[model samples]
Target: MNLALFFDPLADEAPAWGSTTLGAHAARFVDTFPDWRSADLALIGLNEWRGSAAGQPAASAPDAVRQRFYQLQRGTGPCRLVDLGNLRNGLTLEDTYLRLREIVAALLEHNTVPVLLGGSHDLDIGQFLAYETLDRPVSLSCVDARVDMAEEAGAHAEDTHLRRLLMHEPNFLFNFGQLGHQQYLVPTSVLAALEKLHFETLRLGEIRADVRQAEPLLRQADLVSFDLTALRWPEFPGYLPASPFGLTAEEAAQLCWYAGHNDQLTSIGLYGYRPDHDLLGLGAATAATMLWYFVEGYYHRRNETDFTSRRFIRYAVGLPGNPAKLVFYKAKRTEKWWMEVESLADSSVRRIVPCSYQDYLRAAQGDLPNRWILTQALLG
Candidate 1:
């Protein structure tokens, strides 16, 4: 595929960066686009913002984010990075989504993770659709201030994209988990509906109490979409309907780190940044820092999925219920945990799902863990 035809070269002049900076290490699109096939991670900037309620173009948002991202220090190890430049917006919103889907699918086919710098949160619909060609169900995770399930007349894409994803045909979405959603902002009916579907959701307070608990949910995700609106106002002032309360800047970076460390996670989108709304550049700096942590965590991955290896310690807990026992594995090196769930209809089929230590404790007390129950329900 001729990738250059779909993208326009970055508009800004390349800034001179120091030897230790990310700009010095990354292959960016200035005069030439980078070789994406060899890159471990590819950055694609979306210049289409018609999906936003404002219907205003965020033409400079990606470059604003790039300005801060390139100035950061490089990660611990050698980084194979590429900046593919900005995706040229199409004549219609759907055209832009199709372009994004094709680009993301191409990158995924090459086993390269795409870090999308978005024009709006709805672009994740394109990111999600890219997985359809894989011919298997995928788990999705999103961090947002509110669930974007708006069904009202003439709702903007950012407001109604989640509904579109959940209702997309071919039914390839295996699991959907939402993090950092504020209860008051979300409709009761929507929350009830999501719960009835057995989808997982963690309120802002639930996550803020212990951020580490959110790791397992992300660990199982094939893709993650992060809306900058999930962060508190002044901290991330570039997005609309700025809130006084939301995830702290530090918490947002931690979540990104966890997402980066997940071996199963393939693509991630950072969205809802508007350059016109940011005068102090705090939002850009925050987004840049989150990206930096994600890269740092990516290089530090342990590849601990091989449970049969000597590096893992296995434990079995007897249950009083129909499924007589629960099997758990703990990674000796990283201390991460996983539990096994046998299919209800077919005992021969089992799934190794990421879990927290708290889950193990719950099972030891003869109570089923919520994650275990949810996974079993999904399998059934």
Candidate 2:
């Protein structure tokens, strides 16, 4: 698998030089990662917007520099050009999504794990669709400061990406690191819609207070989508409805690392790397570090467990003195995983599932065994 799949959709002037669009930091992220022997890295260059998410086709040089880029990435990486530019090839929404679905399907079918460097976060819609085709269902985890699920109140274009994604299908999503949500900017009806659904959002305040607290919610995630705008000011400045509260660069890296540790996670994508807003290469550099942690975390998790699927099981430590209440949750396969949320009223006694941590940690889904139910009563 190529480590660095570089795609430059902004050909106007080229960010500044060396991935100027993503910023100098992006170049550094690419260069430094290879030094440590991370996964193989491939840079796929694409012509400027031939099509926006709206599918507006633009121009490209069939024989231009991008053509050379396309050729170089073919045999060099885990899969074809990580296909970063959407509009450059797809002139309309359907056109883009269709091409993306095929491209993503091929990579995943062959188990070529991809780390998407998107032209715009909207490109994420294609990535999502690709995995939806998989026989095994996948979980989506978003790390951003804003809840991008707002509807297009007549506004069109790339801005409405998250809004479109939520409406497509019923998929498991975990929105992490959201902050700076302004009522004037995002409609409450949209938030209400999300509530009607069963997705969960972890706000910035909660994470800043304690990152570890979110671990239980993320343990079973398979794919992680990161929007750079979630970082606090000075670290990331371009977020919509920019907020003063957000994760620090170090925090983002740690979060990515933890995400990597999730045995079920398979892919990651980093978006919104606009060099124009980032004069220096700080943002790209930060992103590179975050990616590095993801790699490290994955490696660590891989080493911690035996390869035999039967030996590895999900693990969890319930909050002390909670309740025996249980809620069933689903995993990728026939396995069973459950969540127990109980009120500790004076903390007389409460017991949830009683099983080996090794066993319960790995259970993805199913009804609790009769013995487990009896154990809750015994402990209570």
| Tens-digit per-residue lDDT, 1-380, candidate 1 | 88988888875576789999999999988778789998999999987788887766534788899999999999896889899998988889998988899999999999999999968899998999999999998999999999999999989999999999999998999899999999999999999989888889899999899999899989999999999999998688887666899999999999999999998999999998887788899989999999998888888889988899999999999989968899999999899999999988999878899999999999999999998888888888
Could you tell me the lDDT of residue 58 within candidate 2? Answer: 33
Error of 1 at 205 (Å): 0.3
Candidate 2, TM-score vs. the true structure?
Answer: 0.59
TM-score of each: 0.98, 0.59
Q: Which stretches in model 1 have alpha-carbon errors above 4 Å?
A: 57-59
Q: How many residue pairs clash in each candidate?
A: 0, 32
**lDDT (Cα, 0-100) at 77 in candidate 2:** 16
Q: Largest TM-score belongs to which candidate?
A: 1
The 10 consecutive residues of candidate 1 with the worst lDDT sum are 53-62
Stretches > 4 Å off in candidate 2: 1-88, 169-187, 237-243, 303-380
lDDT per model vs. reference: 0.91, 0.48
Cα error, candidate 2, residue 60 (Å): 15
Best model per lDDT: 1
